[model samples]
Target: MTARSTQNKRKRFDPVLLLVLLLIVFLTGLLVQVILATDYLGSGLGDDVARFQDLSGVESPVTAVLLNFRGYDTLLEVMVLLMAVVGVWSLTRAPFPKKPIEPGPIQLAVVRLLAPLMVLFSFYLVWQGSHLAGGAFQGGAVLGGACVLMLVSELPWLKNISSRFLRIGLLSGPLVFLGVAILCIVLQGTLLDYPQEWVGTLLLLIETACAVSIGLTLACLFAGGRPKDDLSGGRKR
Candidate 1:
């Protein structure tokens, strides 16, 4: 009876176990750092960190490092998000009738006006991503917000999106990125290495495509849809 009880007992939260796991992760990464010793002075305003004055003479290292040096980490982040979509689909039976998420009056009015401007702003940011502050991920996030606003409205705008289309949207970002990477490898010596004059153009194109796909993904997530009606004719109710 005692053996059976122990076997059937629920696993309790163990802080010691959590700490040991974290220690293992830190130690593994620390060993890699010790072996490589390779770093950019990208550490910020925190303690023992170099300031902008210290980092002078270098061009916009943040932007360059993000898109170039840290590209793999960013790529993995996108993958994690893609996986979340699959997890959600598997966990929930979607296209169940939805109630609008609903917003307060002032919030609703603000979102109504800001939505279009935000989209334009996101595009501008993505355009600048190749050189300046933003990139495909940031642009996609803003586009996602626009879709959220629509879903939260008293009148939903996405009444016709099929789940199949949503599945497409979810996969689009990775597929496009993979295609570009493969193309670059075939045409050039490296994957996703921008050719002459093609750097900004390619980045902008990818960002634009990502923004729309993100919007669609957000819309589908919020709508829970394989919607039945024509949503193209959507108007405020």
Candidate 2:
């Protein structure tokens, strides 16, 4: 039986198929690298990597590539976030049954002390993301973790997080991505291809919106309850 189970698991993985896929991916990567190295993408975006070249403190070419050259990937990333919100919402639909599980006082106290700080930290990450490494996804996940902690404590105040806001927060990034893409087409004759005049401002604007929406949507999901119409029993303070 043990040998049979091991063989079944091995069959499921199909190492030969995985190796073939890996080989294909490697070949594709090699092709892209060669293309970029040859300046086939124009001027080697890496030229802008230096602080002297990007005096405004951003790696302009990198930002441009993300929002323009590789914009399809960014759009798909936004879509993934949208789907996550939709999936979670569908999974925890109406008639939210109370599971009768209450946190112990000790746990509740810990949550009360920790949740707000975590949320604040998430905002910090969002705010610093423009020129720094962190961004909306990282910050939002942190905020969501805080919301889950608060929800676990069954605190009513925390439960009053607005449902309308939740929906907006969940959809904001994708909406902005779509909006910007459309605007770029209107202005530049190509989708997501921002005008050179507006590149810096546009990147900042999109990043901010993505951060806030990511934070709010994820937090709402973590909170689990439908965004409140009334906090009858969930009041925080």
Candidate 3:
């Protein structure tokens, strides 16, 4: 009976494995078809973007597309980051170290030096984004890296950060973006359609706010939960 059971089990193919194999084969065929239908010599939308690039308020085509041409998509992406942090906070409390560990002099020195510099560099990236390859996401990533460095060093001040401040930082990006969109609708009867004269300023404003929020959101995600003050019933464990 045991031998029969083993044989039957061995003979049964895994449905999941079969499904995965089918999917792989389908995708491979689709990829081949797409490759065969490729237009390698196409200029694509470069000319269209260039023709309107001056009106985008930023010299970088990528930035113009991300923050101006398709601002709604960027708005949704920022909201997604905020929602991710909210979901994480809802699920668990930040796993902060109960007992703070003192860092070595070298580690402390490095963090102190690099954290500030990284912050400055992040802002520079935000500024450069207007005319170059840098932008809010890159700047925010750098800022988040700096925060992670401080967290790893177990900075006492970081633990004491007010929940209100954190919440404000996390919400600022989406709120500002939504506000701009609504304002555009009110003024121009279209969402995110900045006035020609104000396009540059508005894009900058959005990028700055988004960079700050993205930085905070990323840091909060790294912390893995809500700050103590944000806990229910004002409880702290």
**lDDT for each residue of candidate 2 in 1-237, tens digit (9 for 90 to 100):** 122335464455556767898999999999999977784656554665453334332444444455555767888887887787676655553223345356788998898789889988987876565556565667767877886676666765554456667677778888988898899888889987677777667766776677677766666556553544533355332
Where model 1 places Cα greater than 4 Å from the true spot, the runs are 1-60, 94-111, 215-237
Q: Give me the candidate number with maximum TM-score.
A: 3
lDDT of each: 0.61, 0.66, 0.91
Every model: Cα RMSD to truth = 8.7, 7.8, 3.3
- For 186-222, candidate 1 gives per-residue lDDT tens digits of 8787876656456545545555666666666665566
Model 1 root mean square deviation, Cα atoms:
8.7
The better candidate by lDDT, 2 or 3, is: 3
Cα error, candidate 1, residue 17 (Å): 11
Q: Quote the positional error of residue 235 for candidate 3 in Å.
A: 8.5
User: How are the candidates ranked when ordered by TM-score, highest leading?
Assistant: 3, 2, 1
Ranking by lDDT: 3, 2, 1
Candidate 1 whole-model C-alpha lDDT, 0 to 1: 0.61
Cα lDDT of model 3 by residue, 158-196, tens digit? 877888999999999999999999999999999999988
Which candidate tops lDDT?
3
